[model samples]
Target: MAKKPLSAWPWENLGSFKYAMYGPLAANVMYSWIYEDSYKHPWCVHILIICALRGFMHQLWNSYNNMLFLGNCRIKQQGVEFKQIDNEWDWDNFILLQGLLATMACLMFPSMDDEFPIWNTKGFITLMLLHVMVSEPLYYWMHRFFHGRYLFTHYHSLHHSSSVPHPFTAGHATFLEHLILSMVIGIPIMGSILMGSGSTSMIYGYVLGFDFMRCMGHSNVEVIHGAIFNKLPFLRYLIYTPTYHSLHHSDMGTNFCLFMPLFDAMWNTLNRNSWQLHNKITSNSGENGRVPDFVFLAHIVDVMSAMHIPFVNRSFASIPFSTRMFLLPFWPVTLMILLMMWAWSKTFLHTFYNLQGRLYQTWVVPRFGFQYFLPFAADGINKKIEEAILKADRMGVKVISLAALNKNEALNGGGTMFVNKHPQLKVRVCHGNTLTAAVIVNEILKDVKEVFLTGSTSKLGRAIALYLCRRRIRVLMLTSSTERFQKIQKEAPADTQNYLVHVTKYQAAQNCKTWIAGKWITPWEQSWAPSGTHFHQFVVPPILASRRDCTYGDLAAMRLPEDVEGLGSCEYKLERGVVHACHAGGAVHQLEGWPHHEIGPIDVDRIDLVWEAALKHGFRPVFQP
Candidate 1:
């Protein structure tokens, strides 16, 4: 039987031989399955079933691999080793599974209409085509937005982490990401079905074909379209080849079409250049592979260097206004040159500073002798402290204590009373404000084997105790202040609760009594005292009896002469002291009795000398390191 072409066809090309054959080839299959009583099962029902089955299989495969697969698979047939390729444990997969199930449910138990009428087949087919046309562009824009910086890090980052994407990576994404993509694709299909003018079967066919195409596009297999189709002027416009879609996955932000290149062409996102590049490279190499590491590194370095320039800085002050106006015409070219020069300068300087040994020796070594000296001092101090603790214990010394003075009090309260402490035992009295206290506690615990804290425990103390316990250090809290000690005990984690032992007033008194009677204790305050009358009074008899290997006398001898004078005066004043200076005539007049303010000119070097002396006496440096 000969079938006549419909006279109402919109385009004459549509009735041509190629269209006549392919159109019916698809149409006949849809019609028989849709209209025949034996095949009356709703097209929507079959689609829902297939989608569910595929989603279930995907989940099952992922679950099995995550739970059971323990080793890498070297596929002999493919001559490749797959490393860490399992996807069953991803959050994306879960969201995808849920979205698919929800979509199927929506299609099956549609809010309206149980069965679609058969009489409106043409209208239904038209609606289905329109739905696809509308949906593809929405997907393109939404997908592009997802790849943008703000959203990409939070949502799209997970997807691109898998550079060589597999089937499981397809639907594996966040719920919000999945929902956005699904609504963009699904709303059109639902809207068409509800309009009641289209063939539901045609819509179902489009959905099935679309899903299969997506899977094949992400598949490992290569299926090039026939050369004749590529050469045919009209047919090329009507269909998408595998090469068309593969380019989309390879080159991001390009080739955003699904079924046809109509929208992609209109939007200028088709990426024909990328396709050409891919074809040229693949033809030569016989493989489509990942980009090399060196190429990626070069791009990163170029980007970083470009971003490093201080664009607002004025190297432009010398140029005349008329010249600047004239240069505005070639501003883009000029700016690019300037930016490139800036990037090169920054890169060269950074590389030389970090990588060139001679530059480091000549520029850095002599200027910062403290950098080399401080580390050696720290290592030596740590070793001597450890040996001292052991020796003190062998001599029957029951307690060895270390103390650091608060920097704030060290300078302001009085002269730095404990400035010359033991050499081997490192002590610094900074104004031990909360921040400094925290830093010191953390640093101190790193070298010590055990720490026994005795004080009215505060939040800072409790925090220090907790941190020490986590590092597996044993801490015994001894304090007469029961409330603060109890707070410390309560805040500690359950596992570390036992490491904190609270000592009562009676217990502390008893321990001190026994140590004093036996002359076996070394108090931290006495151990860290300066070699002056101020700290000599506080040094307990038992501390002196212990016969320490290192003493404050050693530090006092090593001290700068100017520092000793400042300490003597600071200790003489029990209360806070101040040194005042006033300018008179052409010189500065110094006053040291009490606080007073006077305005006058001062000798700059005299002020500098006094400031240096203040710093030696434990005043904080006003400048940054």
Candidate 2:
């Protein structure tokens, strides 16, 4: 397994401390302002500023952890280019709606004044405490409702989309979920205003405290309870630690109570044994046993399948994209069309021989050539990568790795390698890339698990390795080749380290055959060649076939403009099953040769061979295409 380099500063700890210290400071300032003027506006302003500042700082910390630490951590455990499926819902819209509603509610409320009834000292404290009480149960109940079979599919599903939650992911939810949830906080404040039960100052304090506590609960950092507090059973009831909150995210049913566990304990819902239960479930099934795939599939069918009716069903065939826009005004139809076209042009057409030839001749090539190298250069393990690794692990597959030597080294002997000493399971480091290294990996991993490819290697090795990976064979890469190694590491998924085994080596026959034996089975149940350059060529058919299947429909659906308004007479058409820009404005050109050609079947054998080689060496392979 590989360790990803840290990319962000440690801001979460600092922000927490700053909030703790500055909160009292701001409160004191508010007290002084209120006393001097006997006016409530200044106090209200101070409270808002302090709360806003704390929220901002808290988010900054969260962003760093979610985007950098957690993101990298997941990649190290998983592979690059992975996606997770938890539930079906739109969390982003949910969060946005909640934010909008909260903002509106705040705006609707009147400002605090000296004569405000809630401004008195006792009233202020009570309001703050009540806010906590109300918010906890409200959120808990709403969350539980979302888990319900009926509502889970339509409303609560979005939050679960991110099985492993990130910071920004915290608020991503559906609009309906947000609307209902926001009212829990909003209604209380609104009622206080309507009844004039206390001073506006008191109400404002409660809101501030409510927000601060929510942020604290959601923070990923672990905060151990004080020894004294832990020892005193009753005191422990009052303090909710970070670990307590994190459990709620991981396990669905337990830890519903927020701020205080008293309510949950009274109802026998307090998940005091949640940690043990979580461990038990994970050990038993290797996944949280909340929802099954069939259940998720059903939900997807119910929601997205219905969506397909708008296209596949005859009732919708006559409706053009423009007409559909009017009917579904909320959807950004124009933007979606434009984005789809743009993506198609970049992904498929740009790689098609005839299209590339036409595009290059039209001067589009020079402008975009620099962008082509960006994915290679800026490539590092990201969230998607981690998702890939986890997805593989869930399928009960094991990843094997190989490290390639530096470019300066000769392929046959100059390049060094490393191999995993252990055959299967756990993280280990090896030192070089060579035939001996490959032998070491084969010996270690023999009869242990699957294989994966990683590292800068021959196109043949890569093609073979990729095929294996796609077929659920665990193939990965590792490299000691300085620049190439770093690139591979960077391109690895966030969760790679947790699942992938790093090895060093190069020999395909002796190491691979001995280890594979009868255990090796191709995805399609076909035998693959283990020797010769033809093995490399064998990998290509699968790659091209799979890519063609994956992208053909998307390419065919693209709607291009017949002519550009400003650009001189040029017409666009699909020629020989490829997009071409022809002479209204420029010279017509045909592709002379294949564009970005790949050779070989990329089957299980190739992946097994390359992966064994990588693990023998200390490095992993670059999993990205």
Candidate 3:
């Protein structure tokens, strides 16, 4: 008898037909052995179970891999860090997609009725075998097509970005890849339904079985040994192992099997190293050199670039109002072009060596956000900060602190917007406004009973205004609007607003002993008001005040004494022996980053992970990291 010639067409291949028939029938894996109408369970219960299952499996799989260091690769490749990938956000999209799929299934074939008992019996077996057989051929061919040069480069490469594939990596394909992959089950099942041969149990089994098998293939665990295949020789051709898929990842030329290697064998493209590599991996070579270098796919490269668009100052004043208005239709296109140009200008991260007190290394992603001192710039800053959050999330920074414009709510909406945007950031964000405000207020209060506050509507301005107002000190509040003044006035303690003198006039600050100017304060005082008066300016491009008495400071990033904790101050020297807050909330924000408990000492670098650090040293987190 002559062996059949290899063909990409599913009908021409026995393996393809087998995969289609068997993979879906095996979907009984989606149902429980003790079956009942799934409607009996509450929707919340189903959601809870699904969440628990995914969470447990994720942690269990990752923890096991961490211990055994299974299939470890790309830890240090292209600046990728293993710790960075250890994120809660990674599961968010997967869970969402799965939930949607599940809901659709439940809707299409409501699980409310115990209408299908075959899911537990011979019916389950029949469907499992039938779908697997049919899916095999279709899946095999589709899988092969994804490996085509064009598709692989444009779409499938996203999956391969992670040199070391983890369990969740099973669903890490591009939307195009996922769309193509979903057809495997959808087509066959729909075909069966149209022919009046379809059953819910069969569909359930097919989806679950597909999920389980895909997860196993990407697990990187050598559960099926070559020795097992040595004893049970037939299983060798039928069951594809992790080693088979890993080799496919390493070099996409061979071992293309969705379920089995029968067609691969028939095509003469079977990877010979499948079993031997598994042995090496399980034994020493694979385990020893677990980490592999990683490369970025084009899409991610685009996103990383977008995350840090270089700040470029361009004057639009040359264009007439009518000319600019005429270009409004093209403004969006122009803006996007300009943004792309900005993105291409630089990389997302900046590495720096500390030349100050400590000899440690630091990395930063500049906000490049526009108008840090402007209220409306919060939108621009928020967008950039989101990118920074994701970038840091990818790089696995445990803690991040927003600097200058990024830290101000009047500028970036504070850390609240950032945290709200990335729920699973895991890494903490600190505007450090509490500490900055506290320090600046503490220092300024020592010298004056009455202080003039500018930009009172601003976040740090509000914090300072409230603290001073509550302390019963006279605060000459000046803002652009009555609404902003009223807003800050309402936030102050009872009777504190009584001590606040509403002053919309700049000259109202003339009699004040100290002036604390916020970022929103335009046409700020450039000269010393009174001979005896001193000024503390928080916003920068500092007041442009030429007076020797004016001191500019930022308490957000400061160093304190070795023995003191949050009690110490972070003062920037405006003059010799004079340290003050740079922005309205600088000192307060710096304090906000400190640990609540002061058992021993505290130190701060780029970001103060003081809460976690203090916890490790027998101190409970007052302000949790």
Candidate 4:
């Protein structure tokens, strides 16, 4: 239950219980006289108009940005937020009610001893600007904390689900997220009021300007002219562009400023891509009908196995994002980062990517971060996955990646059963396992060259085996199927066959310095190998790595927006950690045309060649930490 508001607060004097339940409706009564022309109709009717205008404004911005892309650079090929099922409700309902409720909160705000319009009083303008200054560091660190492992899985990732953010997405956060962000603005307002230097007009100005800039930040469309940046370079220091904030979302670190770049520049937390993406977009040849087709795939948690219980020692469905937000004020649960890494990983339901028009859908899978990992959930999980893929295929999807457990095959309890189920399915199916395997090899080879490749006959493992051979790295292929194992060896080609050797036992997995395995008919119960050889486990039911000895990561490539490590903040590297992909497929697909990748089949060699092309284009793992 919500705490009872003071009687002095709006409508509480009318007996708190009756009116508390209808507070926002009460605001219509309180503020109705202020808008006499609109009073003839119900408040709901007026709100409908407001929402319509808001939506229209969003469309206008999206259209304007598409045009501006001719002369300006975009942070990504797509900046338009694809409205999703969950987000659609929030956009249509939650925001409307929240805005109506804020009418009363706005009316209750206090005034300072002296007041003046921003234009009339330099003091007011100075104080308004100071609000950003005061809020910047707090917002930065708070944002940093949110990115850390525990809070991110619980709270922050909600906002990030919309990878290609829209203007309204600034408020797509959980309740606790809203509360902390409110402090960024509140502290400055309260500070000025306490110090006796604040004014009503200044307070309103700050609030209005603060929100205006945030909308601009997420707009994905930069309205500011390039001439201003060129002629008055100093102005860039005063405020950040939308490209600045987009990099923060895509890169997951740096550019942690609120409405201004002053603190980010001073603290050395800014990344270089702000200008790179901007210049790259601006340098476009301004060709009509040449804009890229922006398509995205969305998934919550992958269906993977789990080794531990989440909060309350219960299945993840019991603890949801809404419940977590409600509990946030009372308990942050930050301690989980140290004592409960696996539990934390399975705690939150993270919708992995963005959802847009006709593409917004979810399977019958329960809302659990790690539900599919439960002992016997394979059949039900695979059924839902097949249905999702079949639907996407029927709808003319270009390519679909059944992320996490969805990629797992049901035979022998795990592998790619979907691709074979309907080989004729027109839509290209990608587990991203191929590209994922490619990137994992790069990360693993960073320290150790020799390793055991389990599931070497599987599609992903085969690609890894071939790629490793191409690099001349030694591989001990571990597989139980003799025919499949020998096939890999026989087809290994002259150059790679010398580096590849096959064995049919799990025990052989530990002989090498590192162990990289795919989903197996039998599970490797321990988090790490008993021999203490570093294990790079790359399957659903991800191996929880405490130290670096057991490392687990997803298998997809993204073009990082900035250099996360050099951005100079421990919070980001601490929160979500870092995963790198070659992004060769993404860049190559971008060049081929819009709607991203082609509709037909794509191969491992094609993606690997893109990796080579990416290197030639000066692309590398941009996130260091």
Top candidate when judged by TM-score against the true structure: 4
lDDT of each: 0.36, 0.34, 0.49, 0.50
User: What TM-score does structure 2 among the candidates reach?
Assistant: 0.36
lDDT of 1 by residue, 236-267 (tens): 44555545655666677877665566667778
Put down candidate 4 lDDT per residue, 161-184, tens digits, no spaces: 875655556756666666566667
TM-score, per-candidate, Cα-based: 0.32, 0.36, 0.38, 0.40
Task: For model 3, state the Cα shift of residue 515 in Å.
Answer: 26
Cα distance off (Å), candidate 2, residue 517: 40
* Better-scoring candidate (TM-score), 1 or 2: 2
Candidate 4: residue 46 lDDT (0-100): 35
- The order of the candidates by lDDT, greatest first, is 4, 3, 1, 2
Better of 1 and 3 by TM-score: 3
Worst 10 residues of 2 by lDDT: 292-301
Which sections of candidate 2 miss by over 4 Å?
Answer: 1-58, 61-95, 106-123, 191-221, 225-229, 245-251, 275-625
State the TM-score for model 4: 0.40
Runs of candidate 4 exceeding 4 Å displacement: 1-397, 411-427, 446-449, 504-511, 519-533, 546-559, 562-604, 613-625
